[model samples]
Target chain A: MSYFSDIYKGIKTLLTGMSVTGKYFLTSRKGAITQQYPDNRATLKMFDRFRGEVIMPHNENNEHRCTGCQKCEIICPNGTIEIIWDRGIDEETGKKKKKIDQFVYHLSMCTMCALCIDVCPTDAIIWGQNFENSVYDRTKLTRVLNEPESKLMPGVED
Target chain B: MALREKNNKPNSLKTNNLELGTQNMKPETINSNFKSEEYQINMGPQHPATHGVLNLLLTIDGETIKKVEPDLGYIHRSIEKMCERDSYQQIVHLTDRMDYLSSNINNEAVCLAVENALELEIPERVKVIRTIIGELTRISSHCLWWGVMGMDVGALSTFFYGFRDREMLNDIFEETCGARLTMNYNVPGGLMLDIHPNFVKRVKKFVTHFKTKIPEYDRLLTENVIFQKRTKGVGVLSKEDAISFGVSGPVARASGYSCDVRKYHPYSALDKVTFNESLKTEGDTFARYQVRIQELWESLSIVEQLIDNIPEGEYRVKTNAVIKLPKGEFFQKVETARGEFCVYIISTGTKSPYRLKFRSPGFSNLSVLNHIAVGGKIGDLVAILATLDLVIPDIDR
Candidate 1:
């Protein structure tokens, strides 16, 4: 009786597990859910919150918001940021507004961390959701986010 | 000779092992027992349960492990040296590659270390986001562990379930941070970006769904009588052994050692979050399971508590992009789902770190195998190894 009982118990246990898998494979709602990645690219939505690459954007008055405080430059643990300052007199309150002659961002060495953008006082920089950061040349990653000739405000938010 | 043999109950029937708490009876004759040469066994660098690239020289007599030595340096990526070449902000992303499974925790640990060194203040919004992401990482890591642990016990279906649930979190992470496994979201002062518009609602839905599925996992693996039989008393790591081995996180707490970094030393608003350290005193495979399952519930609760209350503030601290750390060494530890993982940084006061060392939990957990595997059957060895949840690259790195 003991030998027959042991064998029966083992078989019962085995079937119990198989039944769970069978349940999932047959009837679970999520069983049919599969992400067809490459083919589904058309309907795939890349979220706006993604922090991919840094870009210095300008707004009305053709003004740049960066004051060249260099907070983003100092907080970066790696030496991936480069900034050149252009000093000019402002007509608003007769105060000097520092504009960036060129703001260089090296994407190859950038860890895609949003720290620099976090520390920027003015919303001068924002991470561009560009996943195609690959380049044949390393120098191509060193982009001037702010052009020297773009009409820029000293420290005002563009 | 009779008195000496009478007092000691030998662990094995044939082995002449006289070493116990003490040889109680005075030996009338000492020359009767002869020591034999030890046998050699190879473990890892590729073994399924070696938990990465760790190769251990296990000297054994039959199944009893005698002398065990861990051979390291197989997956050594000179991240510390590489940090010195980059800026302060750039190094935060590299930390993600250390423990690829719990990438958020890895990034936070390194970022916090750099922040402490520079004395950078983080915003309120970033803190809540960090906590949410950290808990999500913990849940994902535990999901992987649960599946692997089930596979160790010869239960295959749970692995599919574990991966099925965890993939959803990976999707969320990929949408938010651009990568699934190595998320470089943490910075010196705060998070890369604020939580997504629908992050809170989606997280709530995920938690609601996850809770409903917990009982299914229990029915599939935890409540099984065979799993209980194999794990209840096998590989019992006592409270004392856990301390001496420097084991932390769930591995140490499972053995009744209350050593949680989040509790003892809270970092990144961990104290503000309401959560209890999951514990069990058995120090065996079953105890480990109990700690992890309880932890999953606690992590879900932590996420449930803070997802909505996230205050609106700046997502990062105001800092420069090309940064330098003051001349000093910065060391920090974070509790990954596995255990305590330490990142040691030697700063030459430059943009990149001078020397960095990652003291990972899997490395130490895998080292204790020879002590536990002795006397247990080979089949139990798989159970023991799977219970440890060894990740090869983590061990290799």
Candidate 2:
């Protein structure tokens, strides 16, 4: 009698397990959780706060907000950001000011920790929403964030 | 020749003659001819059952495992050594790699240690938010463990169901922290940013969705006959042995050791929330599984209590650009999804710590494997390992 009872209990539990899977199987079409990533590229959107890569934004005048403070470079744990700057005369004030020659950003070495973004005093650098950062060449990952011939925005230093 | 001699004797005296002959026989002859030999096998540096790059050397006699020696350092990233060069703010990100499933909790532990050394008082809003996020991290980590536990016992469907629930939590994390896996949200003074505007709304939605799915989980794996049979009495650890081995989290709770760091220490807003420790006296594999499942419910309740009541205030307190701790030692411990995770820092009044040490939970839990797994079969060893829910990087770190 105990042997028969054990078999009955085993079957009953297995059928209960089967019912859970069976319900999912019948409704899987509407309840599917998987996303077709590449195919849905047009409709796909990342969160506004996603930390994909660091980028320097420029207005239509090709002017930026960077005042060459180098705070981000100094605070970066991995030396991912490098700024090359030289003294130049400010056209408006006729005073020599430190301006960036190139804001070198190594995307390859970036951990996406956003430490630099947090430490940036000028708000020159920001998180981009683009997450598709893969490339065939490693050197391509080392990017110059500022556009060519870009200069500091007017009154940004003030 | 010994068998032939026994056959010639009378049936009543045969047993006596055989015993006498064997007692007189040389020990080396018996060892060379009839003794069973123990063999060794490797479970993995790449084995999926290990859940990460953990190499286990197992000694077995026939089907029973004689020993399980965990060979670590395969994925050792030298995170403690790296902490020596990084600033207090920079160190929080590196802890994320240690236990990636509970990265937010790992980040919070380092931040709390730094804050304690600074003697800074955190805002009420920060405390409540950190507690809510930590509990969510616990639930997500347990979700992954549940899936892997079922898969380890040959139930494949649990993996998909577990990941489906975890994906929702990841989305909530990404929207708020900006990264899904390694969320460097906690800083020394407070959080990196305020919780996203939709954070409360989305979390409320997740709590409702997850409440219904937990019952489905019980049916899918918990009540399954095969899962129960594989886990019930596979590995048993007594309360005394659990304390002696220094095991914590669900592993120690299953043994009725009362070692929940959250209950005893009550860091962050845990003192405000009332929840059970989820204990079981059985200490077997099934008990461990049940404890983690019960914890999932407790975590959900914790989120519900704190979600609508998040006080509005400044998210972070301003700290020095170059943070140099006064010359002293500081220690802080937080209950990660695994167990008690401690951060010890010895600062010589510099921007970086002179020495840093992490007391991870997985390493201590892994030490008890050989003690419990000796007499169990190889399959039972896998089941025991699964219920332990070891994150290999957490151990190696």
Candidate 3:
């Protein structure tokens, strides 16, 4: 620990630290990995594995696969959900069945835990990668999935 | 005289060094206390080095600090109030937003608290997985601290290098839980999802890659003479003082206090694992640096040991499809990178908690400022504050 050695160590240490900055500043050649998010969503890829918002899918007859079973409602920990059933008459089958009437969810209240997707037995509801979920008003967050009612039970394989 | 300069100028808070200068006081200030002529200075309401809006009033004369007064409640978001408004499962997300840097731990803490309240039994496999992820969060948090602490002393390059490996940790986190900063991955009783297939392999790579880089970190920042000179004996809080002030984590360990929640009170699967707690006898700024630098290796070793041993089972416990907890008060204390965090929940036998309160580590860490920063040089103030690694939101909460 001589004085001269200490000076040299300080200079050497400084150079070593600067080199890290130099390395990063010079290495902008590294690939452009950032997706530029919302600006380029039309061109960018979205993985199915991406944990996005939850959505209920529909069958070929435009009938929602959500059976008013409340499986998703049960699995959701936040209770950012409310499900209502409506009695609907099937045109072909000519019988009344419980159908999903209102599927309400609050995005602001959502933690995106993804439990609702896992609990849905029919795979009727899936997590969608529409990540541009920012909204100005909390009221707009409460949503109902509007699927057509005409094609309900025209034909069924189940 | 420094007293003349203080009398001539009024306080405006536009200095790299935050100080509260000499002021008149009665001769006898305490009965048993030997510390003399302590002046107080507040560091924040808007100080960048305080890390997030902490207010500290420091007492000083010349270059040695005598008293540091920390005033908090700037960034508090009423997070617990919002939590009680949501259901048991909903509180998990709230935890993520509270401690943005250690979001995983936040998620895990809230979830663990909920499970404790509900008497929910988590699978053994879930506990082990929680332990591994929790340690990874610790590594990332420490890495960021090292870099910023260096920058606080005007060494900017360490900041970038710290983020270099930290970026890898974030990527690993991103792949597992989607969001980078606020990943609410842990839920009550278990994780939100099963561990991804490549998780073990990615972790194995990090263990080898990060171990090699430790020497590089030492060479880059820790070994420097200037750093050692700037930190040694500055802001030295003795073990007795640390315990009185309730300082935990590296701050308390640096002072020889047995305060790490991980070692004394193990949560998750930390009890099953063996890891050394890094300690220093000096209780100075320099000692805190050493404690953190030494702990990196220990944390990495824990990750290495647990990566292969993760049990095969459901990631989270299978609860009543929707979770509802019995009415009672539940309290949980888990180790954050900075110190011990206490999460308190009061339930009225409802879907949501009746009330929630988070006893964040930064509150206690920030509280000790007034005692340490008096009579110290302007240069050492940043160093002492950096050692505490204060996060603003936690303080406000």
Candidate 4:
């Protein structure tokens, strides 16, 4: 008698389990949580704080805020950022000043910890929202952040 | 046959056989020729049930497992060794890879250790936010575990349901911390930045949504007769054995052992909020499963209590760009989703620690597997392993 009752209880619980999934099946179209990726490419938007990749934003005059300060390079945990600087004569002061030659960013080695962005004194580097970083070649991942011929923004040193 | 004759057990069997009119038969015939040999099989390094790259060399005699020997180091990144080379702030990010599920809690552990060593006074706001986020991390980890545990036991639908809720939590983490899994939000002094504008609103929404869905979780899996039968009596770990094995987290708590790091050594506003240590005395797979389930609710309550009343203040206290710890040993332990995750740092008044060690919960929990899995079947081993809820990188690191 107890054995028969056990089977009954088992079936009842199994049905209860099925009912949870069954409700979802009935509301499948309205309740679907999966986003149609690539199809919804235009609609897909990352959050404002999303740390996709590091990019140095240049203004209309092809001028960036970086003052050749190596704070980012020093603060970066993975050595992801490398800044090459040279002493150049300032146009106004006529005195030697540190100017950036290159700002090399290795996207492959970056963990996206955002320490570089946090430590950037001039807000030169910010997180870019473009997350599609896949490249066939490994060397393609090593990118130069500043645009070619882009000079440092005037008065950023202050 | 000659070897059997040399044994005293065979002599007794031969005398008994002679009385039974089988004296004409050889003495060796007294014993049955049927023999069973214990064979070895590797469960993983690639197997789905092992969760990560954990290899278990299972010795079995037919259907029953004789021994389970876990082979680790496959996914080892030598995170402890890496910590020595990294600065104190940089070390937080490496811990994210150790227990990816509880990345926030792992980061908090290291930060707390550094802060303690420096003797920095953490503001009330930072403590509250850290506690809220840490509890949310716990819930999200448990949600994933619940789904995976169900899938391991042949319930496929739970996976989708679990991920659906987990996606919301991941979005919240991404909004505030900029990364979903490896959220290195906790700096040594405080948080990296202020919470996002939508952080409180979104977390409140998730709390209400999760409150309703937890009941569905019970109906779908917990109360299911098949699940109960598979787990109830399987892989029973007694209270004494749980302590002896040094298993912390739900695995130890299931055995009626009171070892909640949060309850005992409250850190980061944990003392401000009240929560019961979810415990069960059965010490079986079902008990471990139930303890984690109860904890999910406890974590929700904790978040609800603190989410609305997050005191407004500066998110981060400005620390020196180059932080050097005073020469001494510092330790901080936080209860992660798995168990007590401890960070021990020995600093020689340098930017980086001289030696750093992580006492991860998964390592101790895994050692108890061979003790419990001996009499169970191969399928039972999978169920037992699933209940352990091991994140292999934590063990390997």
Candidate 5:
């Protein structure tokens, strides 16, 4: 009867499925794809595009491209960037101009969107490939991107 | 005296009710026995089988589900309200949280909406790359679902196999976009960046690798008698019911609905690619499973077409710093891994949208749960839910 044929077909199909799994099971240790995370930490490497944290690159002379335009601050969906700038005398032109006092970034609020980096006119900020960003305290995640004594790079003001 | 009688009317009605209750109780008092009641159970805002923070209020009579009421809003973040406050550019990132498995497609839907409003001409390269990545996203989403579906049906190894392949795709996404799960790579104009140098090579290798692995997938679960017994002819959603419930994606296709957004409304490089939209007439849990499986092959074919032929041009168009849509209504729909994901934006000539609505596929697919699962056994409900492949955040949002 058709009923018996159906029953026979079901068993055949099940065995087919089991055979596939069985092949993998027999393959065993060599087929294992899992990376022993912490144990393999020494060999792990992150990609160049990984959006870990916003960092401001500085030259050997400690001059940076950041002119404190506050573009990043405005473009940020969340209030993740706080640009506190004050008017200071320009060294080359001997004229008053806006200079960055602090380029504050909150890691906790950052979505790793890289939107701020994309919109930055001066190419001052970049995503640093440091994925381990966990912190014990919330305040510890906030940081001033520029060095303590870094100044705006010459010709960036224009 | 009239007012007093009106007030006493309530007392007399209460006395009549008490007399009737005593009369009914007299029969019960003579024949004292316990009666069984339908059992109620809360599946979860925390249950693993729920796939996310989804609560199913199930009324069961001895393991058969009498009713299913989905309790939503556990993961609701008011994303639409948030969109009203955020600029069009910033809104792209928020969509990544909904139907996170198909984040790329979600991002593309929003981007397409804004681009259509502006009448922007996206470069050919952008179109090709977008199509490639979109197919990749579909394959990855299906891979994850296939594994999860297997697990849901009591075959656990499929989970590992599915994730193993999925990790490859995630690596490819991470290499190019920087984020693995919530890849906010699509801007209004085009992609956030060009594909990674190894993107093409890696994708080619993945295609070859996955092609061979699909048979293993079949062997491990698809043909399994136990899986078939559990799934076949269970939770059948007829074409009429499917359409009435507004179910889309594989769920609709399984019921023989030719409603593939990519097929009907070709966007990006979808028109360029040659692929079949997987369809079935059964409309059961197994049919839904087969539809997604067939779609995986089709998605791979779509990617293979565009991956090599990615035109060389600018990755993104130079849009203005502040993107303001014209004061009008704009709508765009894209075929996500699940189904039709639509973004409707009402602009008041401002940087931010006046109102935004995301017509997510999971919401409609989820609506059919009660319709299909009510008469099924409690165990069969899990298989039905698995086939539905609901992403609760998309529903809640």
Candidate 6:
């Protein structure tokens, strides 16, 4: 009697388990959790605070806020930021001051830790929400943030 | 390892003779028998059951495993060594890669360690938010483990069911901290930022939804006869063995060891909440499975209790841009989903740590595998390994 009861219990329990999966199987089409990633690219939206990449904000006059203070460069643990500055005369004051030549950013080495962004004094750099950072070439990752012929914004003095 | 092989050879020979003598087996039948010699096989730095790049050298007689030797160090990034070069705030993110399933908890452990050393008081909001997020991370980690456990034991549907619930938590994490897996939300003083405006509402919705979904998990896998047969009375670890092996979390609790870190050493709003420490006296694979399933309920209760009462205040405390810890040794332990994760730091009054060490739970938990898995069948071994939930990067680091 016990042997028969054991077999009966086993089958019952196994069926209970299968029923759960069967319910999902029937409703899978309506309850699918997966996103078709590349196909849904047009509708994909990142969070506003997403830390994708670093970018320097350029204004209408092609003037940026970077004073080349090298705080971001110093705070970066991986040496991802390099500020190439040369001394030049200030346009408004006509005094000898440091002007940014190039702000070389190594995207390949960046860990996206946001340490540099947190320590920035002039708010020169901010996180860009563009997460598609894949590149075919390594050299393409080492980007110069400031565009050519761009200068410091007036009233931005260190 | 050599002595065990010598001992098994005689046992196999005795079985071989018994096979031949019974029913007077023919010579050709004896020669063709697959159970000849005890063979040694390596199951990945790449195999699926290992869960990560964990190479397990299994010595077996036919399908029965005689020994399991875990070969580690494949994913070792020398994170502790790297922490010596990184600042106190920077070390928080390094913990994200260790037991990545509970990265929030790992980050919190380091932050708490530094905060305690500094003796800085954090606001109530930070404590409550940290506790809620920490429990959420635990539930998410266990959800992944439950799915992987079913898949390892030949059930595939549990993976989909588990991930279905996990995606909700991932969405909440994305809204609050931007990154889904390694949020890096915890800093030395408080969180990286305040909780999202919709955080409480989303969490309440998830809690209600998940409460109903858990029973379905029980029906799908817990009560299944196949799952019970695969897990029950398999990989039995005695209470004494659990302690001696230094196993914590679900593995130790299943053995009736009374080793819940949250209950014993409450940290950050854990004392304010009321929840049972799920425990089972039976130390088999099924008991381990039961412990985690029960904990999911407890985690839900914890989140529900705190979601409505998040105090409003400064989410972050003002600290120096460059934090320099006073020269001394500091240690802090927190309960991760797997077990108790600990961080030990020695600072030389510098911006970076002088020496840093992580007492990851997976390391001690993985050490017990060879002891329990010696005499189990290959199928049972998979069941045992799944219940152990060995995350290779955690062990390696």
Q: By TM-score, who's the top model here?
A: 4
**CAPRI-style class, candidate 5:** medium
A best-first ranking of the candidates according to their lDDT comes to 4, 2, 5, 6, 1, 3
Report the Cα lDDT for candidate 3. Answer: 0.77
Q: List residue ranges in candidate 4 displaced over 4 A.
A: B1-34
Chain B TM per candidate, please?
Answer: 0.85, 0.91, 0.86, 0.92, 0.92, 0.92
CAPRI-wise, candidate 2 is medium
lDDT of 3 by residue, B48-97 (tens): 77677767666666456666666667666788777767776667777776
Model 5 residue A55 distance off true place after TM-score fit, in angstroms: 1.6
- Maximum-DockQ candidate: 4
In the order shown, the candidates' DockQ scores are: 0.21, 0.64, 0.32, 0.70, 0.63, 0.64
lDDT of 1 by residue, B1-397 (tens): 5645664765553434443424534463343334555787777778766556777677776666666667778887776667667766667777776778888998888888888888887777887888889999999999988987887777877878899889879878977776678878887777776666767777888898899878778877777767777888988899998888877778789899998888888787688888898989999989988898999999999888888798887998766655677888888988887788887888887777778778888777867776776777656676777777766566656
Model 3 stretches with alpha carbons more than 4 Å out: A1-6, A18-48, A58-63, A68-86, A90-111, A115-124, A132-158, B1-44, B57-68, B117-121, B322-329, B345-350
**Per-residue lDDT of B1-397 in model 4, one digit per residue for the tens?**
4433544465476556545564455666646445777889988899999899999998999989998999999988889998889898899989999999999999999999999998999999999999999999999999999999999999999999999999999999999999999989999999998999999999999999999999999999999988998998999999999999999999999999999999999999999998999999999999999999999999999999999899988888989999999999999999999999999999999899999999999999999999999999988998999999999999998
* TM values, all candidates: 0.74, 0.93, 0.80, 0.94, 0.92, 0.91
* Global local distance difference test of model 2: 0.92
Off by over 4 Å in 1: A1-16, A28-31, A48-158, B1-43, B57-69, B327-331, B343-357, B395-397
- Write down the worst ten-residue block by lDDT for model 1 chain B: B13-22
- Chain A TM-score (model 4): 0.96
Count the clashes in each prediction. Answer: 29, 0, 32, 0, 2, 0
Fnat, one value per model: 0.34, 0.80, 0.34, 0.84, 0.82, 0.66
Q: Give the higher-TM-score candidate: 2 or 4.
A: 4
Candidate 3 chain A least-lDDT 10 residues: A149-158
TM-score (chain A) of candidate 2?
0.93
Could you arrange the candidates by TM-score from highest to lowest? 4, 2, 5, 6, 3, 1
Task: Note the Cα lDDT for every prediction shown.
Answer: 0.77, 0.92, 0.77, 0.93, 0.91, 0.90
Q: Lowest summed-lDDT stretch of 10 residues in model 6 chain B?
A: B1-10
Name every residue pair that clashes in candidate 6: none
Model 4 Cα displacement at B264 (Å)? 0.5
